[model samples]
Target: MWPAVGLTRSLYLKELYVARSRWRSGVGTVLMRTLFEVAAKHECSRVEWTTDANNPGAQRFYADLAFQQLPSKLFFRADATAIEHGLG
Candidate 1:
């Protein structure tokens, strides 16, 4: 869970399980709206988050909430391969 910083900016989602009965209750939409309202109350200019490249469902969810794609790429590198073996 992401912690909310008072009177600042914070963005995150309320996790929902992939259960058929739960989906029928429309809880996801409610949760998203609540999050947006909380951020807005804090005077947040923007809310941001990332989803896996292959997660079309997640992409669609964010898009529906008016999130745009940022023009940047994220890169990752590590020096140590195995700490126990002292190899990097």
Candidate 2:
């Protein structure tokens, strides 16, 4: 994750996943706790991450960990053709 600046200046958790067989076994909790510890060690104020809007499971998992949901728009620029025109 990048050391980002601006609002919510903290470590970003880009991705996190547990094997299907490990669900509900506390592995994710342990991993998240460790991640938070590392963030704190690095003097980060918090951790940030995102999941697909349709992913209720992930939403629930994050909710259980007391992670709040922020309303934000995610934009994408798929412009391979524009790249050729130096506009990407």
Candidate 3:
């Protein structure tokens, strides 16, 4: 998780992954709950993450945890080469 600049100090979760064999277990829930606990400890305003649209399981998991989908926003990636080229 990376902290955002501002009074609220929001956090952005880069990614979350669990072993395929661990599916249907409570590990994901526990992991998320722990992440929230950490965010609370740091007084973070919110925690954000992104999942591929192709991964319905992940999407459902986040939705079950009350994470709203921001369909209006789009996620972009800038690799090292792209950045080095100053967004060409």
Candidate 4:
């Protein structure tokens, strides 16, 4: 969870992966619902996450769950190894 513009906080879901054996078993939906419940219990204003652009199945899953795409935002990451040595 992170601080937001207002008094509310937001939940950042870094990752959510279900095992291949659990696919099409409604596990993802249940997990997402539980996540939302936990977030609401903690007073989180919203939940933000990212899905691979190449994974259409995952994208469709999120879209089916009513998660909007923040097209304007780009995700960034700093590899732990690279972070120690500054990029050359």
Compare the candidates by TM-score and give the number of the best one: 4
- Pairs of residues clashing in candidate 4: none
Model 3 residue 37 CA deviation in Å:
0.3
RMSD (CA, Å), candidate 1 to true, equals 5.5
lDDT of 1 by residue, 1-83 (tens): 23444545566443544465675356767877776787788767556556677977767766776777676947344556555
Alpha-carbon runs more than 4 Å astray in model 4? none
In terms of TM-score, how similar is model 4 to the real structure? 0.87
How many clashing pairs per prediction, in order? Answer: 0, 0, 0, 0
| Model 4 C-alpha lDDT versus the unseen true structure | 0.89
Error of 3 at 48 (Å): 0.4
lDDT of 1 at 80: 64
Q: Which residue pairs clash in candidate 3?
A: none
Q: By TM-score, highest first, what's the ranking?
A: 4, 3, 2, 1
Total residue pair clashes for candidate 4: 0
Better of 1 and 4 by TM-score: 4
Whole-structure CA lDDT of model 3: 0.86
Q: Please report, as a residue range, the 10-residue window in candidate 1 with the lowest summed lDDT.
A: 1-10
